[model samples]
Target: MGIARQLVHRLEQWFELMGAEYAYMATDRSNEASLRLFTGRCGYSKFRTPSLLVHPVHSHRLRAPRRATVVRLGARDAERLYRSRLAHVEFFPADIGAVLGNALSRGTFLATVGGYEWGGVDRFLACPPASWAVASAWDCGGVFRLQVRGASRLRRAAAAATRALDRAAKWLRVPSVPDFFRPFAGWFVYGLAGSGGRDAAMAAEAVFASIVNMARGRAAAVAVEVAAMDPLRGRIPHWRRLSCTEDLWCMKRLGAGGGGHADGWDWARSAPGQSIFVDPREV
Candidate 1:
């Protein structure tokens, strides 16, 4: 805990010197040690519970909404979009250009309509953290395929019942456990942002579908992380909630400035905030 405080303090000081407004971090709800270190000792406050949902590539194609048009975005276009709309996003990094140039990322995409507006998604590969640590189920984002078309009535009924239970658990504010896989690798969609109201949202669905289709060709699953306040989430219903982990987003204010809460804002101190947008890489 002492080491964590020291490391975080130094990093925060550097970010403060760089003129950043707030510092952000994220971890699983199960990680009590990290929660305590950041929230208790380091003065960070939990803000959002970003869910990691996974799905088969084919599923995205099946669920893609009609009239939605999406386009692949090069790094230059992606960076421009982020800069122009930074005001609408929370917990975003000022150095978006470097983030786009990151070698770890596969590519970035944009969802648009009539060439008037765009939304971007940065894609990354979920590599094993370390060699000794074996691959787990979520490493592939939990693949799901719908093939009840040729199934017997009994089999179809069983599948329906299972899905119903999953929905029920979600409504109760819990996760539907994921099937873990060994030695898995796949694509992870990060930094999804959309504006332009319903027009932008509809286009976002096609963008997600494109990622899903690409993953399908590689025989891998794709995962997307987003907060509840993100409107684009309501447009994509094909992704399944992973019961295995919940992204606990935490933040802490830097200097003595700012309005409302001078000491800083703490999400853990009250109900989850209605708005949240912590980038996955920051966590």
Candidate 2:
């Protein structure tokens, strides 16, 4: 077999040894050779389309028509913000409420406007000295969520939020996670706009700007994972030709499959998986 084929075989074997039931590589839609290499040669199937968004810290070429005003969100304001988001999106209030409440408990930062809350961005910046000792073993990348009531308004707020995150990263001196994990990181922004509220061109611009801004804040890379399709406007240009990994699959190992019946693996009862990607720079 050729070198490329050998590499693919090795990768499959390695993942299997590590107990991975499903694994697939992601590549740019424009890269036909890569697509062929993974899907044509390897026994992988097309799964989903995910758009990756990127924004360089030094580059701010995308311009917004309106300037967004950002300020720290207070405790009461955070609750209000959560309520507003629940009203706009089709999310379980109980689940979103618990998330926002926990963020508040963990000392999350919030952004708001004119006493009315549109969205919020939270982070965990302070870590113990010991936490830094083994930072290389953990993925210290930050995670944040942005929600807006309307598409036009969301665009404005997302832009301002993106800038704010970048500013925070600069002050903290940590390279954004999205930037560091590029290509492998996968970045994109998913927005839900009301029908007839905005044109496709304007909405696409806003989503692009939001993702780029978030990326600029020092992330190694950024990718937007949209769980469902939007009915209003079709897929945007920047996200027209995106792809995604296959759905993670798991199975149970019956008796004697690997060990005795008492030692058989029960995939259905397996604990949820967790992964950490610590930034080397932190070490």
Global lDDT of each candidate:
0.55, 0.36
RMSD (CA, angstroms), candidate 2: 15.3
Error of 2 at 281 (Å): 13
Best by lDDT: 1
| lDDT tens readout by residue for model 1, 27-114 | 8899999998988988777767877666643322344555555456677766765666453555566776676666545566655554
Q: Which stretches of candidate 1 lie over 4 Å from their true place?
A: 1-23, 29-37, 58-63, 113-180, 237-245, 254-283
- Cα-lDDT of candidate 1: 0.55
Q: How would you encode candidate 2's per-residue C-alpha lDDT over 253-279 as one tens digit per residue?
A: 322233324665443334432111111
What's the residue-level lDDT of 34 in candidate 2? 64
Q: Estimate each model's TM-score.
A: 0.58, 0.34
Name the 10 consecutive residues with the lowest summed lDDT in model 2.
128-137
